[model samples]
Structures are given as structure tokens and as C-alpha cells.
Target: MQPGADDPWSAPVATGPVRATVTVPGSKSGTNRALVLAAAADGVSRLRGALRSRDTVLMAAALRELGATVTEESGPGADQGDAEIVVTGPVGAARGTATIDCGNAGTVARFTPALATLARGDVRFDGDPRMRDRPLTPLLRALRELGAHIDGDRMPFTVRGTGAVPGGAVTVDASDSSQLVSGLLLAAARFERGATVTHAGHRLPSGPYLDMTVADLRAAGVVVDVDDPTADLLRAGATPAASTRRWRVEPGGPRPLDRVIEPDLNSAAAFVAAAAVTGGEVTITGWPAATEQPGRMLPDLLVAMGCRAELVPDGLRVTGGGRITGIDVDLSDFGEAAPVLTGLAVLADSPSRLRGIAHLRLQETDRLAALAGELGRLGARVTVTDDGLAITPVPLHGARLDPHADHRLAMTYAVVGLAVPGVTVDDIATTGKTVPDFARMWATMLAG
Candidate 1:
């Protein structure tokens, strides 16, 4: 049977040790961004290794709604092999009134609206109830300054574009989510005046995402102010010799670059966490030596918790030495990994403190609270602070773990099930939002 089958709940017992090398799919972050950029670009872009998960599908559908032609090329082996997404942009075409369903995807909810601002006429966007709770005021306010008409601050909003966005200078505090910044940056090059963005809020959470956006923008041949400091003389795309907290994208337009997307490193973390907890070894193929994906930092975190992490021809091998020691990691730069870290922390021999990720509160669910509550149901003791989680190595028993319709949280509980017996995960289907084959892959990874 295919993954995410008939059973809505998955409770796979770890029979003996987990030893397998899993090949995860493309990065959801990268795939969604590529989809948006391809749609916003002036020419057609082909995305090789694009992920086909619920989240990315929402992104693709949203782009299609905005009048882009998204073709998923299929052949004899395309279903099981690497597939490609060919996006024919509707640039300057009649991207008339359309409706977008974000479907619990923050990227689609936050990123696509900016792209819609480039299209003409009305574009209305709505999503799952949870999306309504997610933050969008900053992005909306920023888009408003860029001369787009928005109906509201949150989900179920409308963007009225007059065939062009008179983009110049706008500032938004990207401290909560970097999508607001990255989304605007992705479409900035297509703006009539280009776009200049500055962060007016506290330090941007997940600074790497900002860098990733700028890197992609530059790679697409958009002019970026390498350093937009107030003292430096500005270029043609300049708003002002701005503060260090600013980013600018020149108005020349976006260039479509043919590039293969990287595997979702965060998805790979699930297999790594399995190896970490079961005192076994798991290899992830094609692990990059250098990349911008936040999952790149997992090897370092694994090494800190009594695991042997090494890069070999086989892949990035993480050998769980049958013991997990307490790890104190400040995961500020990569909050996406926090759920995986939390699962490992509970099974450690000592207490682990994960600091500097309070921004996780604004994620799909109140991540810290949801993680604490779910693990607590499994007879684990965890304390939730304002910013992070403090987990003690309390022997955990099995219980039903609700996924809260969040894919990452669902996968995190699956990791715990590798060591603990009878850890039933409800709504395992929720993992389809990112890892569509999450359960089937887990079952295969556990095959003895």
C-alpha cells in the first residue's frame, strides 16, 4: 500500500534497533519558494526535485489560482522517481480575479499575497482556521506601504492590484516569521520601482531565511545592495543609504534559473532522531556539504548528544551510541528543528534546555505548549518557559500523541515511538502536509 493509507492512526513498534538509510524528498521551504519565484518570474522556470506534499500543493494551487501555468510532468517512472514542476508565469497577462486556499500552509498564506500584488484585479485568500490565528499584520502593513490594497490583517484577505505594484520602500518587523520578508523579497524584482525592505521590529527570527531570500534574489540576476549601511553610497535600486537592517531588490525583473532543489533536511531529522533515540545508525543520502537549509545544523546537534555524526560516501551517518546525553542548544537560528530536539531531549540521560526559540509560539501550533502537552500525556515531565522548553529525562511510557494538524509535530512524535512502546500517533495523515509518505517511509525504515 502507498504511504498514509487507510489507518488514520499509526503506532509502529520499534522491534529491535532501527538501522536504515532513508532518502527523503525535496525541501518544502525550497520547493514552495521556487514555486513562488517561478510564478513571479518573467519567464518559465523548471523546478527539478520539487516536493509533492500537501503544503507544496497548496503553494502550487495558489500560484495556479493567481494565473500561473503549473505543470507536473509525469512519465513511466515519474511517480517513483524524481519529478519536475514546469511553471509558465502569467506575467503581465490577465491574472484576473482569483481565489487562493492556503490550507494550513504559512508560506502560501504569507508569501503568495505579495506575488498576487503583481497581478491585476482582485485576489482573495483564505485558509484553514489555524491560518486565521497566524500573524500576517506585519506583511499586510508592509504590502500596504508598497501600494497594494489589502482588505484585512489576517487570513481571508484580499489583494487588489492595478496591473502593477509601485514598489519602492517598505519596512516590516520580521521578528515573528521570516515569510513576510522573504515573500516580499521574492516578488520585489518584478515591482515597478523594484523594492526596498527594512526590518523595523526586533531582530528577525531565523535570519538565515532572510539570507536565503537575498541569495536566491541575487542568483536570479536581481541587484541587491550587498551592504545597505547608512554610510555606504547607494546604487540605482537604492531607497536611501539605509540602516544595516535593510534589504533592496532592483527593478530589472526576475530571471528563472534551472536548479535542482535540495532534500528537506528538516524531514531528514526524523530519521536522524530515530537513530539518536534507538541507539542505531541512519544514513540520509545526498546530504550537502554546504547549504542554506536550516536542517544543515542537525549534524552538529546530533554530535552534541552522544551521537557520532560523520559525512561519508554513504551519506550523513548519525550513529546513536545507545546513550543520549543532555544537550543545551540555543536553537535561535533554526526553530524548525526544535520539535525534533524536544523529542530527543525527553529520552536523554540528563536534563536538556533548548533556549532562544520562543518564536516557535507563532508557528503552526503553539509548538512549545503542544510539544509539552503531548509529551506530558506520555508520562514525561517537561517545563515550558516563555522562550524555550526544559525537559528532564523521565522514563516515558506510551500514550496517544495528537498531531494537532501540524506535520512537524506529528513527525516528532513518530521519532519518540522509535524508543518508547505503544506510542500511538493520531491524525498521522497530518504529516502529508510535508512528508506525504511519512508513515509508509517509517514502516519501511523499521522493516527488519
Candidate 2:
């Protein structure tokens, strides 16, 4: 059984170099995206190796509420919780009243609502108390602009679907979260006139996730034309400021998918990071040669921090030197990895500046403030920067870390604990939001 939220877990410290091979579950982002696309597809879509976690489970449930059938059965030779998800789709216009509990999952809160607009009756969306603060206004307003009738400006809102949406052009400021953009694009192909989205924000973080959304849509046979303004701006020697990174999706039925979900590289990074911290080696099995997931940059990031990373036939292997060197970097495309990277940076030889992540302030928790407070509590000099963080290495000690209900924070502190003894994490089970059995996985990696 998983630990409860109130449970305090003593994070295990490494006795020697950690040498192990770790395999992670399916991608939360990919699974949820596949669920949405499957619900919109023409026929049955089968997803093998889908992750069973709070977020993905909530996503499947939300789709079911929208008149789609999502079933799960254990796959042959699959790990615990690994299942083949069968989604019978092209949810019709007869879908009646439905209520979606987003449960603080950003993908559910953002992506599910777009699918709700295609329903024929009232669809109410609500989530955990923390979900009320996440950015939904942009997506909601974009839906409204595309002929969707929404009752409120935020969560606990009602989507008064009229059985059809006259999707057309709409401009959105999605700097706060890329999910807003992905949510719109995912449901656009079903719109009567298709859909066109233009980003007018000052900055667009997590640009790679948008690529993932577009790629998934293409895999489903949706025609998407992306107009990136950066190339033109660079040709003119002008810095791009997000004038309009537009995407146009033509109205059509997405082809049913039969694909295997890839391993979640974001969550897998912690194990590879264990190697970096303990001066050991770790191999992450089933590492894809290419992926739209932003975590694909892990090898480059590790190499920048004085670690050696190689892609082997089976997976990606990382070997850490006894010493870690700091470097300056911008994590706009992969800010979700910031917390764990910050933990690694605390042990670096020089100061580290992580920039382009101000939007983290509005995620599961105010990540910037939480990381600053929690890391500072452990005797590290962490200053919350405007767009990211600045960390200076100092002698550290173990302390009970409060993740403030954020799973990333819990994992980040746990990584720090592998080096700093006596460290404890409040609500280590919060990692279940993504990694269903994080505690066991960490222990197994260390035991090897």
C-alpha cells in the first residue's frame, strides 16, 4: 500500500556509489494526451504501457464522464499497475450532463475541459483546493472565443456545450502554462471550422510540450501547420518576444491509435541523478532515441554538470564524478525538471543560476518559494530569482522537508537526502501523483 499524505518518510542515504538499472512507468503527459486524442478519435484506440497514477487515473475518469469508454486490463508480462488501456471513442454529441474532478492534475484540469466543450449538455469541472489557483483563464477564454459557452472564469466552472463548436481563430497568452496551448490544440480538429491559435504572450515556456501536442495530433492524422516567429526574428537579428507562434488544425476525424507509451523520462531523471550525487552509475532502461518529452535533454544537462552520460543500446547510462561543477542555464522548455536539478546544483562547486521559470510560481504549489524555503532549511543558500533560482553551495545538514503538497518538491528533497543524512520528507507519497511507487523505486535503486 502507498503511504498516506500525513506520513513522514525518512529518506535513505547512500552508503556507497549507487550502481543500478531503473525502469520507470509510462509518461503521464503522453498517457493523458493519448486519452484525450483517443476520446476524439474515429474508433477504438489502444494504449499499451499506460501509467496508472493519480493524474492518469483522474484523466481516464474524466474522459469516461464525457461519454467515452476507458477500460484497463493487465498486459502480459507487465509490471504492477502496468495495463493496456482500451479507449472506445469518437464520443458522440448525445453526451449529457457530466462532472469532472480534476484532482489537481494540470493535464486533467486543462485538457479535459476542452473535450467537454464537444459534449451536448452542461459539463461541470472542479478539482482539489489547490487547483483553483492554477491558470485556467487563458484556456477558458480561448474556448469562449472559439464559440464555447463557459459559465465561470476558473475551476468549478461549467461548460455549457451546445453539441457543436464553431472553432476559428483565437489568440491566447499561454506564458503561464503550456497545457493551455496543448489543451486547445488537442480538441481543435473536431471543431466545425477547425481552429487556429496565436500566442501573444511575452514568453512561452515549455515550447517542447507544444511540439509534443502537435506531434500527437499529427500521429492521429490531424493536419497542423505551426508558424514560429523565432526564425523570422532571428533572420532579422531581432530577439523573439512571442509575437505569434501560431498553429492551425484542420477539422477532421483523428485516426484511432495503436501505440505503446514511452517511459516517463522526467520521473526517471531522479534515478540517474542518484548516480550523479553518489558518484556511482545508473542506467535508465527503454530510453528513447528521440522523444518530444522535454526530459530528453537530461543527458546534456547532466553532462553540463560534470557528469558523463552515454546512450547505450538498452538505455541511457550516467556516471557521476566525485565533484560537481555548476553552470548557468535556462530551463524554459523543461521547468518541471527544475526542482530536481536545483537539488543537484546545491552540491555543485560554484554558483548556479537557473532562469526562465517564473511560471513555476503557479504550478502544483508556488514551486519557487517552496524550493527556496525547503532548500534553505537544509542549510543551502537558495535565492528565489525573478525567472528562476540562484543557488550557492554551502555545507548542508539533513532536515525534515515540507513539499507543500508538491510531488516535485518531495522527490527533489529525497535526492538531496541521498547525500545529506537524517533527511526526512513530509508526504513522500505525494510522488504518487506521477510515480505510483516512488519509495520502492528509490530503495531498489540504492540497494543495487
Candidate 3:
């Protein structure tokens, strides 16, 4: 049985030095986008090297609900071989409708509605209760403006696809999640006259993820035009008349493809933090130097915090000795790393302030609150605001931690427990949503 959100974790046991090569999982964002594109494509689209994490699995299941044929097969390589998900074109009733369960995945919840526009029937989208509570008003308003019939119920809302979405300018507030914007862009190609999008207030957080969406659309045979004057404005070309098209997903692990996903820098962050706090040396293998993911800035940030981190051919080598320093840095690009960095901040010599993370509140959990609240339980002074968080370096004492059923929070606190004795985390199972083998991998690194 799955553990409840309120459960408290066991105290952390002593963990020794960590020295081993670790292969991170594929990007959840990339796999989810590929699954959606494959479903919208005209021919049998094959996705290679796809991630099989909970989020990706939910996307696959959602596509299956939409009447796509998805297959999984092992690849013939050192890394997990290719997962051959074959998407048969949109074969369901032109007006067919289905209720999709997005589980706890924010990516699926946001992306699924846009895909519904191609269907001829009413698509009722539902998810875990927490997901329903997360705001969808911005995306809903944008879709309605584009002529989509959206009923605004919390979880049991119904979206009726008219196959006639207007291709004109629509402004979207993407401060919550960039997935909403990506979803609209994904469906833009299918519109009769194409579409234009403008970001309303502050620039969308995780802009790189949106850029990835645009790049993926182009790779899948969709044309997009960006207005130079305004960074937020974008124009998409009409869906290609040719329904049948073929594209190859590049393989991972030391590949030189232009757009292949680099190893998950976010996942590597936990181990990196572990090494830093324990005064140990751990090298994260498979990270590319030119990657755009915000987590890729770990080495530089760690260096700024007085840790020695070098980028190697394989991955990153981090060594810890000197006292950690407080940093006041804008994290608009690497918002996902904020939680782990917050944990590090608790051990720093001075107070640390992380800014530009207002978007974090809308993630899988209210990450800002979760971080501040849960870390406070471990005897740290953390203050959370609407925009970001401030941590006054306090001598951390080990205590039970509540992960709030968030994978990143669970893993971040778990690493924190390694340094601060007696720390335990509740609902560690949630880590499987992203890193299924987190326990085993962590054990292996400790064993080395």
C-alpha cells in the first residue's frame, strides 16, 4: 500500500564516503512532450530512449486513453535500451471524448487538455485532489479565448474539442507552470489559422523549458516564428497537411545529437549535495557542459558557495572542505534546484537568500512552503514569501521530515539527513515518481 502524506520518515543512519558513477534518468519534460507530439503526429511515431518514470508512465497511459498504440522494448546498450512507444495517429472518434487520470504529474495535467483539442468529443480531465487544487485558470482562460469549450470544474472539468481553435493572439500567464504554455504551443500547429502567444506579466519562469517545447515542435515538423521585439510573443504555423511523418528520437549516453536530452542534472543534484555536506568526493557522470537545464548550473553555484566542483569528461567532480557561504542569487532559470540549495543554505556560515523562485509555489507542491515548513521541523530557520525564501544558517538538528508527497522535496531532505544526524523523511516512496531506484543508487554510492 502507498504511504500517506502525513507519515514521518525514519531517522537517517550514518552514511560513509560516496564514490561511484551514476547514470541519471531521462528528462520527464522531454519524454512527456514527445509522447504528446507522437500522439498528434499522422504516422506511426517511434520514441526511443524514453523515460519510464511515473510522470512518463502517466503520459503514456493518457495517450493510450486518447486511442494511441504505445509499445515498450529494451534497447541494446549499456544504458536502458530504447523504449519503443509507437503512436498510431489520432484514431479515436474525430469527436471522441475520454476522461484522463493525470495522477500526481503536473506535466500530464497541464499538457493533456491541449491535446484534447484535436479530438472531436468531450475530454473530461481529472487528477489527484491536490492537482485539482492547483490553479488552471490561466491556461483555461487562454484555451477559451482560442474557441475551446472548457467547463471550469476543479477536477471533473470537461473540455469539448471543436477542431476549430482560432489561430490568433492570446495572452497567457505562465507564472504557475510553463507546461500550460507548452501545451498551448503544442496544439497551435493543429489550429486552422495558426496561433500567437504573448506572456502577460513577468516573463514565464523556466523559459528554457518553453524554448525546448518550441525546438521539439520544429523537430516534429511544426514551423514556429518568434517576434524579435517581444520575447514573449510567438507565432506558430498551421498544422502540416501531410499527416504521416517520421522522426527519430536520439539515443542518450555520450551522444552528439543536437537536441538529445542530457542526463538529468536535477537528479544528480541530490548526490552532489550529499557529497558536499559529508565532506566526501562524488562524481556525477553523463552531464553535458552545454546543456540548458537550470540544474546544470550546480557546479558554478556550488563553487560560489565555497565548494570545489570541476566539470569532467564524464560528469562533475565535487569536493567539500571549507565552510559553505551564504549566496543571494536569482534562481529564475534553475528553480528546481532551489529546494536542495535551501537545504545547503541551512548549513552555511551566514544567512542565504534565494530569489526569483515565485514559480515554485505551483509545482507538484507548494515547494516554497514545503521547504520552509519541513526544514523548520528539522530545526532550521526558514522564511518563505510569495516570491522566494530566506534561510538563516542555524545549527540543524535531526528530526522527522514531511516531504509533502513531492519527489524533489523527499530527495532533498533525504540528502540533508545524511549530514545532520537523526533526520528522517516520511513517504520516501514518492521519490519513485522520478528516481525509482533512489534507495538502491544511494546505497551503492555510500557503499563505495
Candidate 4:
């Protein structure tokens, strides 16, 4: 087994009871949309209780690059203790050309280009080397077809907006990331002519998120019409010009948000799987019964594996008593939870076959290969197909687990290592990008 000491994760330790109240952060998707909307709107938008994660930080920085004055302060009121971001619209035209470094923030990488259409001069969009390599060809082609001048089809690309965008029917293959489609839809609302987007292949993976984007656009005074089973369309029937606008963002924290961020079912899956693997009980609260986030399927899937999952008033409670069983399930909607599911598969009593997950290969890392490679190192018999993973349960003799510098991989493997005998990860600090207190929270849960 290859030691994953070179990766960014910590050594795994034993875990105890998983009872704890976790106050997850605000929704990354919502925060990004609010930032983009605030930037393009005419007035000073006060976004209260925004997420202060790496991804949101990147979006805020990108907004600044687009000539918006962004200021960060604490709370709706001085006593709330929640963070507030105030964005002043572009003074006149975007003052100067700027280079936006999106880092590994896919939201910034995808959405910033659309905002670039509003810039006065050329805006160069780039990101971390890994991010630069991620495919943006679909988005570039769509934008160019819409009359935006994009230097290259890939990153390190230059975008010069003519202050006007011509919209038409654009076909986008969003099999990689839904952010591409969302970006085009957002930019289309501001187009001189309306835009209609047709999915080139199978329907989008995160349908709920795409719906959320449309809902948010409507909230910002943009009229969006989503005719299901047909191409979703946005018609800017008339140019609705606003002199200035003010938007108050919902506050942050574990307390119920006006716009409750659907429980991070993706994150909770790790703990749920951890409890399953360790033959213990784990309960995650605040998971909405009606959540659009696809990751919310964790409890149902865990229950299929013979784990007892009960949906309580606040959240889902999971208990593992019998041996873990593997069942075939389609992960098209819940693609983000694939990493954790792969880890769970290794602990199952029978061979676990996950299907409808071809999109996993395109995430932060080639997740399918990364999972297979790392899990194989932990003595699991894992095989990868074009779509999903097929794994036969084995006693996980913890070897070094590499996170491939991806946050999801890091956290998922950390949970696996904790339940196993000896597992250590390299570069654990990457968890700070999303769930900074992952280790602390895990420690607290285990302490009880």
C-alpha cells in the first residue's frame, strides 16, 4: 500500500459517539449567486450573514476585480456577530483591466467570465494550475456564440465585453459542472436579446441547483421561465434598467436562516458513514425535509445499506448495528457525495456498485481514479468503470490515504481512516477551505 504521507491530511485516530450539534456554514451556491447579482445591480447591496469560506472569498475577490467596491463588516446589527458584505456598484464603467485569480473556486472560475462582459476593458481570468486545467471549453464557446470576445477557449483567457451581449440559442454540455450553465443563464438576463439554453446530453446532474439559480434570478428582478422537459429559457422581454438597488442578505450561523442553507448532506455523509463503519450511532441535525441540495439523499441510501436511519424533527439520525450492506444506486443527482459513498463501499459486507456517476471524473480531481487508487492502498478491492465505482468490502488495514489536494477527498478519507486501524493523511490544512473546524468538530463528537 502506498503511504499517502505526501498528501494534505492528518493521521486518523479512533472515534467515539457521534452525537453533537454541528453549525454548518451558509450555502456556497447561494452566497456566490448573491455576490454576482449584487455586483451587476445598480445600487449598494448589503449581504448579511454571507459564508466566509474559501469559495465565497474567491467570489468576493472576483467581484472587486469587476469594479465593485466590497466592504466586510460584522453583523446586521452590531450585536448579531454575523458577517456582512456591502457591495457598492461599479462607479461608472469598470475602471481598469484586471486579472482574476479564482484559485480552486470553480464558482468564481465559471461565473466571473460572465461578469467580465460588463467590464470596460479586457479581463483576464485564470486560476490555480489545477483549476486552469479544468475544462471551460463549453462555457467559452457559449459566450463567444453570444457575442462576447473570449481570447482563448481555455483559462488564461481574455474577455472583453462590448457593454452589450447578443443572446441566442446556446447548447452547453454541462456534464462537468453545472456552474457553466448557471453562468450563461446569469449573463443572459442582461443580454440585449434573451437566451435559451439546451442541454446537449443527458439532463443536468444538479437539477435542483439549476432551479435555484433561476429562482435567485427571479428574486433579483430578472424574469426567468423554466419550462420543464424542454429547454430552460430566459427572455429579457424589455430592458429593465434600475438606477440603484439595495438587497439585505440573510444572516449566517446554525440558527435557522430565512433562507436555510440545506444541510450539507455531502459533509454529513462522511460522519454518517463513519458511524456505520465503526458500528456506532451518528445524528446530523438541521437537514431540511424538503431540500433541493441533492446530497440530502444520504440517509435514505445509508438505510438501504442496513443502517438504521431515522428522520427526526430537526435532522436525520443514523445507527449502524448489523454489517454494512452494499446496494446499487444511481448517483446522478447526488454526485457530490460520491467520495464519501466510495469510502462507505469499502466497509460494506458485500460488493458495492455505484452507477450514474460519470461526472465524478471531472470534479476537483479525477475523483473516480483518486478514490480507487487511495482505497486500493487501504486494501480494498476497488475497480473503476466509465460511470461509477465497484468495490468489494475488505478489512480496511489503514495505509496512508492521499487526498489528492482535494477537500472532499481529504475529509472523506479522514473519516475512513478514523474508523480503520492505522490511517494518516498529509496536508490536513486543506479542510480549512470549506470545513475549517472538521477536525475539532470530529474530536468533539468522538469525545461524547
Which has the greatest lDDT? 2
Q: What TM-score would candidate 4 get against the native?
A: 0.85
What is the lDDT for 312 in model 4?
Answer: 86
Show where candidate 1 strays beyond 4 Å: 1-8, 75-82, 92-96, 226-244
Compared with the true structure, what per-residue lDDT tens digits does model 1 show for residues 109-157? Answer: 8888888877777889898898898888899998889988889888788
Q: State the lDDT of candidate 2 residue by residue for 1-448, as single tens digits.
A: 5567788899999999999998888889999999999999878999998888889999998888888899987875244346689999876553467888999899999997778888778888999999999999999999999999999999899998776899999999998998999999999999999999998877788889999999999999999999988657978899875656899999997889999999889988788889889999999999999999999988999999989999999799999988788869999989988998999999888999999999999999999999999999989999998899999999999888999988889999889999998888988888988887789888889999
Go through the candidates in order and give each one's C-alpha lDDT. Answer: 0.81, 0.89, 0.72, 0.70
- Runs off by more than 4 Å, candidate 4: 1-9, 74-82, 90-92, 230-263
The candidate with the higher TM-score, 3 or 4, is: 3
lDDT of 3 at 307: 78
Question: How many clashes would you count in candidate 1?
Answer: 0
Candidate 3, residue 90: the lDDT equals 53
lDDT of 4 by residue, 204-314 (tens): 666666777777776666766654433222243433221111111121111111232343556677777767777777777666776556666777888888888887876
Off-target runs (Cα >4 Å) in candidate 3 are: 1-16, 75-84, 94-97, 228-261
In Å, residue 3's CA in model 4 sits off its true spot by 18
| 1-448 per-residue lDDT for model 3 (tens digits) | 3344455655354366555666667667777777787777666766665667778888888777666666765543213312445566653543246778888897888887866766767878888878877867788788888778889846768878665566566877676677767877876776666667766555557767776777777777677765423332233444332221111222111111223444667878888877677767788876777765667678988888877898788778887754678889988878988988998899888889999899888778899999999899888999997689999987778888878778899888877877788887888778777776566666677776
TM-score between model 3 and native: 0.87
Model 2 lDDT at residue 293:
97
Which pairs clash inside model 4?
A: 7-426, 8-426, 8-427, 8-428, 9-425, 9-426, 9-427, 9-428, 43-245
What is the alpha-carbon lDDT for the whole of candidate 4?
Answer: 0.70
Q: Following a full C-alpha superposition, what root-mean-square deviation does model 3 have from the true structure?
A: 7.2
Q: Which ten residues in a row have the lowest lDDT in candidate 2?
A: 74-83
